[model samples]
Target: MLTSSNANKKRTPNRLSQHLDVLLFSRTRLEGIKQRRAMWTDKQRGIRLSQHELLCKNSCGYYGNPAWQGFCSKCWRERVRPAEARRLDTRESGEVTTPTFSKFEEKKNMEKGRRINTMRRLFWGGPSPPKQPSDSQMNALKAFQKLEPGDFTGFLKTLRSPSCQRLQSRCTAFLNTMEAYHALQVQKQSDLVQDFYQSFAEYFTSFSEAELTRTMEHVEKLIMTRLHKWVFCHDSCDDEQKDLTLQRRIRSLNWVTPQMLSVPFPEMQSTITGDPFLPAITAIIEMDAKRAPQDKLVCVSKCSQHVFEALSTSNSEPANADDFLSALVYVVLKANPPRLHSNMQYVIRFGLPQSLMAGESGYYFTNLSCAVAFIEKLDGRSLNLSPEEFEGYMRRGRAPAAASGVQAAACETRHLLDELMSRQERLDHGVDALNVQLQTWVQAVHAQIDQATSQLALVQEEVTDISLSASSSTSSDSAEIEHLILTDEHVGSPDTDC
Candidate 1:
């Protein structure tokens, strides 16, 4: 209204001079960031007081000045103390003395009699006086005055004479024969020093010292004394004159016979009194009932003649009838509740027959032909049997007619068709004896692979003639190293153009 109040008081001092130049440029950038953080904290406390005065002058030889205060003004003027310099030279020189005790006991009794006369002149042999008679001790006293026979003044006037009482009875019989030859040389040198300290306490008790000198040379070759003459007639006989000459040579011997004293001895026939192998196993079951079913030979000749007369009247040893018929055919095919009929499940469920006779069928067919000839010689080198386990052991010895009866079904169908055609002819003769032992083990592995391929072609022709004589000695050492590199390049050629 008064000319628009003079242009709005000139834009109000230009907006209060732009807020006093942005509050004096934010108070001069906060006093230049507090004087650059107080000059970077006085340059990090002057680099930590110059790294603590160069780490106290490289640790303790301290050329100091840690802001100077307690000593160390570079080793405080080379410090010195020696008891305050010997109390200032004993207060500038002022002396005093004292020391008596009878002149120290006459200087300790003249140093204790000069160390007991120098340890009695080093233990007695030092007096230095006696050596006078030398011309070889006056020629060994004139060779004991020509072997002195009666002279030490007529042996002291013949020791008052009677011919010196026969020279004192021959000098008391030569000192009782030199004390019985020095008591038998001190009892044979105390039994050779108690047999060398009981053989060095039985060779160092438990060896070492080269195993006690090889066990004292194997106890001096096993010291059995009488150094031999048939060990000194067997230690001079005497065990009651060798048991009265072995009971007068077994009462004038006569080899024993009468059928070896009526046999028995099948291990003393189970302590005798009967069971003589049950009358030779009932005469081998009446001679395997007169043969005939392909001539029943499984009779094992009366159990191989009563196990060869019980191994020749029990001297025992025999056994191996094919390992006792393969342990009696594994105790008649896996024994388990079987061991030959406890009425073997009512004779394998009713079919009986085997009325074991003929010397219990020749001891049960010589223990089943010694266990089918020891499992046919261990299945002729291990095929281990198959053909249906040998047709189930010939159909378990066929017989089960509902537990056999009707008068033992015609001797159990003729002993089960003669033990099923003698076990199908012993399993077709054990597959023709294991195909003739696998063609004799393939002709002994083709004659040992043709004698190991002719000894590996004569050891590869002697390692190819020792690698052609080591490649002709490495081509004659590369022609003598190319004739010593052409005679060292023709004696180091300097140009005589050969």
Candidate 2:
């Protein structure tokens, strides 16, 4: 009994020791779990504090960024926006409206938008910008007001009075001269415009420089086309053509006369010099050359006395007959800017002036011969040669035929060159168009090929899949057949019972 009790004690102590160790282990595990939990809580608190510092309520620090971290689902209510803020603002603003504009307003807005877009493009470093207004366009604008006021065609048909017959006869003579000259020299109106400017510098004297420029612009706009037509393709025998020419010329004359006049003069139709006025100018100068300055019988304007006075003075002496003739040429051109392109303007402006002013000199009259004489007249110097020598010298002026020949040759050459250039341009345009079409066709073909290739690839993939599926089915069938055969063999064996 004592031994058994001692054995029980030993067993008891061993079991208790085992239980104590288990309890101690359990307590230690519980303490470790508690400590780990506390540490996890502390780490979470620090993370939360950092998040609170960096983020907007329930959000990561980043916002409005394109990256995925711009929003965090767990950390932000912003991740699932209800659209309420946007909806409320829109709702409070009432229904949406579209504004409309008048044509002028639309144009203004369009211009404003264009300017804004242009400025923005400049800021960004874009391509070349729109063209600004040029000098010619501004000149046109300045002249537009003056041009707007006239219905000149209406006013010109009222000039058929019997009292105006003498003036009308002179006009007829001037027109005849112009027609004859045009039939002689095929002058262009553009060349004639330049000639007109040279013929009478007084055209510019009436207006300020700016106003003159505008006036010139007006002439180019209004008068140039009619003048050009008259120069190139006039046919006055055709009454229709004659009427049109008359009307245009009359209108042009009306506009031009006021501008071409010397200060004291009024209108051209009521000129003080009349009857045989147009032809009288040349004859008067010839008569003057025949007589002395005091006895010179030239019927000139009152203002023309100034030129005579200057000529009669002892300070300057003209070297040759040409210089003496220059005074006359200046006087004639100043007196009237003739309606005739070739007759009056050409004769006074180019023909007679060149013959009169030209001599062997430094700049202008560079290569010309001289007719010499020895006498004293108006302008202090004069030629004392016989009328025959003077007449021969005057008659032996710049040959019209040579000038016409050169001009015709030049016009023909220019026309031919223009035709060739035009043909070449057409061919180049054709080639470029063909090239664009070829490239477009090739690109279309390539696209078709790419599409076909993709279709083929899809078909091939489908075929492959079909092939694999067939192979898989075949293998399954073969395995099933083999298993069935083996089962049959087992069933059919002699020692099948075992």
For each candidate in turn, the TM-score is 0.17, 0.20
Candidate 2 to native Cα RMSD, angstroms: 50.1
**What's the lDDT for candidate 2?**
0.38
Q: Write the per-residue lDDT of candidate 2 for residues 260-312, one digit (tens) a residue.
A: 11112222233232212233344334422211111111222222344344344
- In the range 145-253, model 1's lDDT, one tens digit per residue, is 3333323343334333442343234334433433344434322322222233232233134334443333332222222111111121122223335434433332222
Error of 1 at 309 (Å): 46
Q: What CA root-mean-square deviation does each model show from the true structure?
A: 51.5, 50.1
Error of 1 at 302 (Å): 40
Deviation in Å, model 2, residue 372 alpha carbon: 34
